[model samples]
Target: MAEFKPVKLSSPGHSDDGIAVEVLPYGLTIHKLLVQTDGRIHDIVIGPENPTDHVAQKYTNSIVGRYVNRVPVGTHSFERNGVRGDITALPNESPLVSLHGGPKGFDAVPWTLLTEKDALQLFSKAEAARIRAQPESSFAVFRLESPSGDQGYPGSLIVEVLVALISPDHQQKISENTPQNEVDNRVGSLALVYRAKLREANAVTPVNLTQHWGFNLEASLNKGPETLSVKHHTLTIQADKIAELDSDSLFTGRHVPLTPAHTHQAKPIGKDFPEKGYDDYYLFKDDLQSAVPTRIPLSSFNDDSDFVQDLLRSSDNPERGLRGPPAIELASERSGLKLLFDTNQRGTMFYSNALAKSSAGARKKIHGGSGVSGSGDAYDPHTAVFLELHHPLAAFLHTNEKAGEDTLLTSEELYHNYVRVDITSKQSPA
Candidate 1:
């Protein structure tokens, strides 16, 4: 086992409103996300007490790729050379499926930091020779020359990831006399942007990548009286359909309308935990694109009159409907903490951390200097939730992109995906 060494990065000059982020080379995992709220600081993301524990635990705050979610284990048929052929994938934890790119996937390996300027750029490459030699080990095909017979797939691949954090201008906008309502809206807003690009030309491959960052809005980095479980947090997702899962927890390739109980319309998480904890994929509503005017092009309108009217409306009220409702929102009334998630991905996996355990000495003391001591505590089910954004699992199996389609990526084209997460504080109702 390798020892854990983490590098901490903060905003220039350690601004009070800025966030302190920690990353580990192993898995290029985000170990901590600290932000100031009220008079105290909170680590809203769930993480292991010890950095090395990341390897033993599930993909927490790690970059999962190659294939983001699940694929059938063993040999599976894929399109190659315009003919159906078989490809083998590595299996982990489950014999019937390969998860997060198998046991040795990107989440389980170390990534090199290519640059550290306005954003963090981490690079990992899968060499054709190495991938061919280790057919049983999981490997990333993007941003690498996979070649034919590499991981039972054809062609080479190349991929790149860029991560950036944007903080609000609290110093300039926030003042001592700032209204409580205004301050509530201004403070604690942190934005995380994840952008990925496939860099191979004339190559076609299955590429789905996502970050696994769990949130406990009311939770504290230091064990103290303010620490609260996520049981009381309210959740809302702008999804009307969810992917169905089988007994083994793999998607059954079916989509079902969400029942009232499963609908996340600002409902408390504890109310639904008894009915099988949430580990399902929520499909974003089709009309979500309309919420943003930029996504609605002039060509979408049949007549010049309608197009001109819409253009006027959009320009006259640029910020009017932009802040409607996010794809997902999680809030804790007790701490007045709220988190909003938005993404261009088609699906978001909502996992409630039902399998976490505090036993076996897996727990450790909190980080930072808060004068709070450890109580040998364990996290209960639903104490935290992970929202992973990505395309539908096994989408390549059903997609047939034409040569010039914008959605289709050719050797000269690139696939770019983005997800934004914003953290804010809201005032409790009077």
Candidate 2:
């Protein structure tokens, strides 16, 4: 792992106007993540570092580039008014088009950490992008400059990453019993915000953007069980449609029924997840809304003790070997998480770790306070399911009655795309 610089995370009312996040001088970005009951850090993001390198390779906690996620067989061609661009860097090799901005993806480039003492952040510009890779004939991406036509993409884009440490008060609360703790109405700032913005490069109209990051709520270094829960979690998705996964749980052409339309509705992630994890896009039903309220069933267990074991176990039926399907026991455990969304962007992809399974000689371990343990896919199936987001109502945004709609990306569209996660364990600002 590359040596990461750290950022000092503090409470609210802590900084000046232009500063979205107060950073340190190291190359690393410090994110202030709040911990709850038992004082454990269940809130997972990248950069904190993982025991294995597979995660780093998977772009864990890193800001990745130009176009995120799978773009349909790597061929997203467009003819703006008559100009053609067959973005061939996509779809991973064997492509008629481009994928992820070609091999020199944004993740591969090393970003400079803007720092000032114990506060530092990761920031990248459009000008820096033009230095490394070549562009396409019709479209190009010029870092810090107007968009180039060499990469078959449009307009120049700039992206930044910041992390902060927050909420040090929860140290005692998390250590105490039951998570039904009281909230302090003090004026202390206890959260971190990752602010992202996008404006057209050379005034090139609009663009579609999103963040693709995989998450597993019950992750601990000593604990890596496939145990997960969606039941009683009361998931309030903002969308109307569901994108089903193929046999492998990757995005297929099928759209499944999106359950839990209005209120609280959710099943164990594994209950419906196939042998592999779930990897599909879900359509949002609510637009211009804030907060996707989801409650963890951890404290609402039928039998809290029994539920804990199930949540910690890698598999219930080990005899079936590695291919056995493991349903989640959301009957127990509490993530103490109240995910609140704060973005004009739309869509969220809820994926499950379908590609996870035990390694050659891995063992399942457990912790006293942390609960369960399993080295990702060590004992149970531990794959990653990413929640990806994109432009609000992207599919039908430009469609018209007489003429077909065009989906042309914004130059600044390449700037920032994401689903900002807020650990709202306390009744704080989301």
| Candidate 2: regions farther than 4 A off | 1-38, 46-56, 72-76, 79-86, 91-101, 115-152, 161-209, 221-234, 244-266, 286-332, 357-385, 392-419, 426-430
Q: Residue 199, candidate 1: how far off, in angstroms? A: 6.3
Q: Output the number of the TM-score-best candidate.
A: 1
lDDT by residue for model 1 (211-316), tens: 8878887666344433435667899888988877777767666669998767988999877565557788887787764332211222232222121111111111
Question: How much lDDT does candidate 2 score?
Answer: 0.33
For model 2, residues 126-159, the per-residue Cα lDDT tens digits are 2222211221111111122214442444444443
Segments of candidate 1 deviating more than 4 angstroms: 1-4, 12-15, 79-86, 116-155, 170-183, 188-201, 221-228, 290-324, 367-378, 398-410, 426-430
Each prediction's TM-score versus the true structure: 0.73, 0.54
